[model samples]
Target: MKLVQFWRNGRPALGLQTERGVVDAAAEATRLGVTVPEDMAAAIALPAGELERLLTPLLQDPQCFTGAPLAPVVTGTDRIFCIGLNYRQHAKECGLPIPPAPVLFNKFSNALAAHGDCVKLIPDYKKYDYEAELVSVIGKPARNVSEEDALDYVFGYTCGNDLSTRDLQFARGGQWVLSKTFDGFAPVGPCLVPAGELDPNHLDISSTVNGEVRQSSNTSDMIFPLAQIIADLSHHFTLMPGDLIFTGTPQGVMHGYPADQKSWLKPGDWVEVTIQGIGTLRTTFC
Candidate 1:
């Protein structure tokens, strides 16, 4: 089921996308006096099969929602785990050798913006770059998970842009935090598709900047696939529901271009990150 959040009468509510029209889950539940999940987190945490069945009647109603509007699937994510150099091509583009393990990094929740939200270009950094990645959403508590079963803990997937400030990223000691976690840097969620719907190995993922394709590849090329990433990460800390893990980007970032030919993202530049079977996440720079 394609789940979303949309505004109904100026209040944020959950939606279940169906053939008739998007079902305003929260609205219908309230009208029926049925208990509605408190927030997106709770809604997702609810036993999906049972919850879906309970809401099926309302979900089939055409008048359950107002006009379809924008809403992020969930708000206030607890953690944003980002992987770096997990794609062999992306590693080579930066003139670096393939890593021995998944290169892990992080972005604060402050970096998250919904699809259609504007990413503010930090005026000082003219060399902004985009990295299209597959974002994994954790659905259950996980600690010390094995690579074999790690994927079982995942809830779904989404598309993300790991927007980077190249200068700050490479300058000084090359710490990625300041360069990559600028406010509104991560725009996700046209939809968060259930993992059951996709095969992580063969999906097509692409990134387009201002209508021009800049990055295109398949998950088959990932150096550290989802299961390994989950297992490795779990060895250190517990992976909780609502924590988003960006699996890493493919090659063709602007920073990978020849120095003389490089061009950074500017105001009004639009970016779309599309993962086959998942959904496209589009955002504009301000």
Candidate 2:
């Protein structure tokens, strides 16, 4: 089942994207006199198969919802962790050695942006770039889990663009957090697919600027897959439901290109990040 969050009655509400349409889970539950989780976070915490059981009735209904604006697929997450150079090709392009372990960074909740939202670019930064990524959403609390069993704790996966300002990122002794956590920098969604439904490490991921493709590669290129990332992270900090892990991006970022061939993103550019099985997430630069 595809899960989504949408604005209704001036607030974020849980939604289920089905063949019929995006159903307002809360509204449907109320109409049917059934109880259900209120939002994505609550839904994620539901016992195994419970969410599906509760929403099955709503999915069978014929009614379809339309005209509501989408919110970020996952919200109120305690931590937003990102992996750097997890893609071998990306690291090769940048001429950096592949890290021995997953390199971690972070973004705050303020960086979250929904599908179709317009992202405002900082006027002073001229090296804005897009990194198409596969995001793993944790479903349950996991601490000191082994790599073999890491994926069992995943709630689902979604498409994400790790929008960055190369100038800020590599300047002043490397201000990674400041460069990466800008408001609207992490645009994720379109919809979230339960982990059981898709293979996170084998999906095709790509990014397009305007109408042209920029990054095109598969998750198979990842140097450290999602399972390892989860296990590695769980060893240090407990992985909680709703916490997002951006598994890094493939090659083809503008920063990876030769100086003479580089073309940075600017105002009026529309960016889309697509991951196989999930969907495309669109963001406009203004």
Candidate 3:
């Protein structure tokens, strides 16, 4: 179920990674002459169980499967809701107290890009940094949901890089929006794994800059875990399919280190965010 929206000959198309270098789901169906909607968003947005049926043919194809070509997971996501300092260890490293609830923040849709897309380093800020995080993809519209039922609305999980401009994130006089939500700042998706695949509470998340590991922690350290976050966030707005929730990063960020030792991200640096069950999300600043 590694769904992706790809461009073939300048046209937007949906594809799924198979053994044969990303079988063009829609096109393959057209060839077999079976017309089925294959757009990644449309398939996910379809009523509950319908998306699976659309992929049944491709799953059973005799060619056996391969992987996909380079393509962004989705062209657009409704919202990129992010949380700040939700990890206890991370909070301690930053010299901040753990909050009673999820410390929420947000990244705009413009920040959405594929795993390997280059993150554009704007001239506005000098301290570019990386925050490796686990991203949740909402499967259904949910509001005022109970913690027990919170995860039911989730379609899958993925890796995300919450790229930031530290100067604007903290040193700015205004909101965090200036520091977060910059274009190409949030790099998401190598694959979107179904919720049933992993225990959201105990999964491990880690990040590496170039070849050096910088951040390593498990979701177990999260002060506000998935259910609580879903409940809290849904209290204010309806969570819809394709919407993203960026769970906060763990400690070891450059900002957590002393000012003199902070080695912020620079152009030509490669970042890889990896979650235990979900695959790695790789990006470069250029």
Candidate 4:
């Protein structure tokens, strides 16, 4: 089942993309007098098979969610972990060597933006870039998990755009956190596909700017695949339900272009990140 979060009144509400249409889970659950998760975080924490049991009935009378806008697929996540240079071709384009391990970084909740939301470009930064990536959403607590069992902890996958400002990223001897984590920097969604529905390590991921394709590659190109990344990260810290792991981007970023050919994103641009089976996440810049 494809899951989503959308705005209802002033708060975020749970939604499900079903065969009938987008079902406002919260509303349907209320109408049917059924207790269901209120949002994505709550839904992720539901015991194994619980979500299906609770939501399956609601799907029968799908009340197509319309008019109201979509929110980020996840909003209450505790951590947003990001991997850098995990793609071999992307690393080669940046002139960096393949890393011995996954390069990890993080973004805060404030950076989360929904599909179709307009992201304001920081005027001080001249090199805004787009990174289309696959995001893994954790379903349960995980620590010291082995690569063999890493995927078991994942709940689902979503499309993400790791928006970056190159100048701020490379300035001051590398302020990765500052370069990343800006408000609305991490726009992910459209819908979250349950892990069992798709293979996490073998998806087509790509990015486009104002309708022009910029990056095109598959998750198979990732140097540190999802399993290894989860296992490696779990060894260091506990992965909680709703925690997001941005698996990294493929080749064809503005920073990878030769000096004269570089074209940074500007105001009034539309950027999109698409992952196979997971749908597209579109962001507008202003």
- Computed on alpha carbons, the lDDT of every model, listed in order, comes to 0.83, 0.91, 0.80, 0.91
lDDT of 3 at 58: 71
Cα lDDT tens digits for candidate 4, 1-286: 8898889887888898765657888778878888999888888888888888998898776664555799999987659999999999999999998999999999999999998899999788889999999999999999999999999999999999999999999999999988989899999998998888999878999888989999999999999999999999999999998899999999999999999999999999899888899888999999
**Which regions of candidate 2 deviate over 4 angstroms?**
none
- Give Cα distance to truth, residue 134, candidate 2, Å: 0.3
lDDT of 2 by residue, 180-204 (tens): 9999999989899988999988899
Q: Write down the TM-score of every candidate.
A: 0.92, 0.97, 0.91, 0.96
Residue 216, candidate 2: Cα error in Å is: 1.2
Over the full model, what C-alpha lDDT does candidate 3 score relative to the true structure? Answer: 0.80
2 versus 3: better lDDT goes to: 2
lDDT of 1: 0.83
Q: Which residue ranges in model 1 land beyond 4 Å of their true spot?
A: 7-12, 18-21, 31-34
By summed lDDT, the worst window of 10 consecutive residues in model 4 runs over 59-68
The worst-scoring run of ten residues by lDDT in candidate 3 lies at 62-71
Determine which window of 10 residues in candidate 2 has minimal summed lDDT: 58-67
